[model samples]
Target: MSRTPQAQTRTQTRKVRAAEPPLDVAAWRPAPFLPRSDARDPALIFVIAVLCFLACLTTLFVIAGDRAAGGWAAQLTGEATVIVRASGGETPDAAAARAAEALAGVPGVAEARALEREKAYELVRPWLGDVSDLDDLPVPRLVAVTLDRETPATGEQLTGALKAQGLDAVVDDHSVWLDDIRRAAGVVRWTGAGIFLLIAVAAGAVVAFATRAGLAARRDVVEVLHLAGAEDGYIARLFQLRFAGVAAVAGAVGAAGAALLGALLRLVGGGEGITPALPIAWIDLLAVLPCPLLAAGVAAVAARLTATRLIRDL
Candidate 1:
């Protein structure tokens, strides 16, 4: 039979196509076992982000509060005050001046000076304001004392020095105040740590719950994949990666929110965070950088554990 050249080429092409091995379409275009989008994803992200935001804020608060406590402790550690009472017809001013001189000579004392009468009155007026003869009463005067940072003088030493000079004075080295500050700082640190840990645990629990829900919702797909020889680990990893990505996005959003709030505090407070107690800084915002990573890690661990357990049971 006679045939055209085009017919011969088409016949040759069909023969070559028939001779080729079957293509593994799956290997070439492998789809994810888990769907990329889920209705619960947005809610989970929001919850995780809120937790991260709280954790980051707690960190900043601890830093600022600790710094403030340290500053206050330092001031008290390097200073003392003296109450000088006049005796033997000596005037209040004279008594204070004499006490100051004696304190100045003590070892570890940096400087001492008599506080003005008005300032001394201001200190006592709060407690004795109700007294009828407040002004007429022989109010004790104050001697301002500065101590060396390394070898600061003790209250006893200041008192002894005053006694040696025949002056009546009581020294207050602010030990009580220092102790209070130390205790407060410790409490703040411990409380902040506890809160941060709580937030992390909450985030993990959320991730675990979501993973369980996802596994339950797609039980059919999971079973098919399991029957088709997908290892439990491989199945678990899909969920782990999926939830980790969601958590990471949530963490970023939360961290950004916290950082912006912190920045606003810094800007408004102007070096002290709107109060002398907290002194937020621009560098503090850097603390949030690791939040997303931390969130992802936590979510990954939680999802992996949950998914692996559920898959094995099935």
Candidate 2:
């Protein structure tokens, strides 16, 4: 059908406008880089929080264990115990008094004192539970010996000297038990470091996975941006910002929760036993305070790398 000149002109105008583009590429604002589907994934944040929590705990435990090991090493190094036993109708008290005198005269012995019978009984009461027949026990007299600071004597030397003096006694330098404790502490420290490394890797994996998923879901948009000359850095920056924000919030929550738990444990335990052994220095608090920031940095780097790689591949 033939149309009027004005009608033909209107139809031509509509066709040209339709063929040009749906929206202006130069002027139109890009939709939110992070879509609702990816942003609303609560599981990612929860997983990050859990990992951060465990990491915080592992860090604290490692620090505390290291401090405890040092404390034990320092306290046990210069100390020795001498046990004086009764022999051939001689009382333990007489034997202990003689041994204490002999130890005092020894070259490297700083001081030696025999523990009184009542004190010895009190020491055993914690394990034996207030026995009425404590006097029936064949407990040897305990002589607490302090070694000289400059010339500390070894257990063998001390034993030989005491024996030469005709004293019935044995010396315990506490080295055997201390070495075991130090070894165990070293194992714990290494184990904790391994766990912390694993957790950090897991956190990075989570962020990378989320970035890949987001990139996959928005492939068409990314293709448009790529065609429109959007650089990889720009795209990566978007992902970095989004993921870092999420990670920072989640890590803060997790770290805060762990710190509260630690505080509660210390409160309930009354700073006795294990609680007192933990590292309570201000530096420890400083170390823990930046955990959230560290997590956020990890997430940001992970997201940036993942997004850049995926975009380059595309």
Candidate 3:
């Protein structure tokens, strides 16, 4: 049907308005260059989180173990034992008492005490069978010597003092056990450090692989961005931000899990950690706090390097 001039003009005006884009297009925010999330994101998070959890736990264990070793070594270093044997007309009890008195007068000796007769008997009971009479067993008496921590007496010093007193005694300073503990602590520390480094490397490698996959999958988008005049560094920055965010989330989850387990160890094991060998403190949880930041930093560097290299090829 033929319309009037005014009606025709109104219809044409409506058509033009509908065909043109909205004025709000100028204010529209650009979406992220990369997809907000992906089907593989959760898997990546899980892998990274697990790695971080192991790393953090290793750190806590090493700290606790190292501390326990130090405490044991210190205790052993500050103490010694003297075995006194009766000679001539001396009785076991009298000999022990004389040895204790001589040791107490030593310059570095802190406190010297002669153990009771029953205590001495208990020491030899396993060797002597179930004998009710242990007094006639001819067992050597032991004098416990507590040395001053600042100037602890050595085996040689104790032996010389006993010799000068004209007593038959042997000093055991426990240097052998102390050396073993220190060596074990050193081994444990180095081993833990190696494991931590390995985990970190694995995390970085995963992020790098993810970056390559992401670039390959979104190759078309990357080409378009380059065609739109985006620089290589700019493109790389996008990926860096993406992986860093993922790593940060994963790190937080892993750190939390590790810290929770540590707390449980502290509670369940009482003064010690999961075992008497490991005595974890509440302060150890603080070590996990930086896990998220470390993970993010690693991921960011990995992603940036991978993206930059791949982008150059494109």
Candidate 4:
């Protein structure tokens, strides 16, 4: 019991060190249920991302198609065209001008004007390519006819009236052609919706399959956890969180890929035909922003359900 001052100091230091608790590795570290490799696998993420990409693309198409169809239908339904062919004794322009005058006085006719020569040339330039003798090509004259609210002048009636005025004109009601376009747009919108649904289902199935396989792969560990009084919900939550994280990242990547592809399409198409630049709107951005969250939620629900059912059976 007798010690020197230096020895006493050393003894006290040793006591203090001994009184401190030992490092607890288990408390500091979390239980490793799912392997990091399984959680980090890029294959599942890539697959999910691809599915989300397709879903996003179809969604864009659906939105754009609906808007375009409605706009076209509205514009075309109230318009008509009168084409005056060149006659032996008179030019198409003369006949078209005369026809326009006749249409101006007709009931329900709002406005009628012969299309300018330059405008007509521009319209035909796409088909004829670069041509110098465009005027000499005997191109028919075009008259744009706008309809009033009380449209009583039918295409046939306008045509007959022009014929009586010694102008060889044919009337084209845009309503007829636009009706077919609207039908086609409807088909496209429905098709896009169907494709989007299919993609979402496929994504869900993939998540479900992955979750089931993971459960089977780690059955022994799961059973040990179960034996240790770990609740089924606790175990299920692990998988749900892991898969949900994976799906969120994958869905984001997929949405970006879809946006890139859509940009490419709009660039290549040059805002022509059915492919046009998506209009900048809050609704469009809002529609796309939830994709990752939705995918993650779906994955979480699927994983949770699958894990719970399988664990219960075991």
In every candidate, how many clashes are there?
Answer: 1, 0, 0, 0
Point out the higher-scoring one by TM-score: 1 or 2: 1
If both were scored by TM-score, which would come out higher, candidate 3 or candidate 4? Answer: 3
Residues 1-314, candidate 2: write the lDDT tens digits.
Answer: 89999999999999999898687678888568786445456888899989998998888778877888888876677789998898878888988988888888777888988999988778778988868988878878989999887788788888987898788788999999799879989898999989988998999999999999889988998998999999989998999988998898889878887777666655676544236567544344445677789899999999999999999998
Tell me each candidate's TM-score: 0.88, 0.77, 0.88, 0.68
Top-down lDDT ranking:
3, 1, 2, 4
lDDT of each: 0.91, 0.84, 0.93, 0.82
lDDT of 4 by residue, 40-135 (tens): 369999999988888887787777677777777777777889888878788777877888999988777889999988888888889999998886
Question: Candidate 1: misplaced stretches above 4 Å?
Answer: 1-28, 130-133
Query: After best superposition, candidate 2 residue 244: deviation in angstroms?
Result: 2.4
Give the clashing pairs for model 2: none
Cα deviation of 219, candidate 3, in Å: 0.9
Report RMSD for candidate 3. 3.5
Estimate the overall C-alpha local distance difference test score of candidate 1.
Answer: 0.91
> For candidate 3, what is the TM-score?
0.88
Per-residue error for 114 in candidate 1, Å, reads 0.9
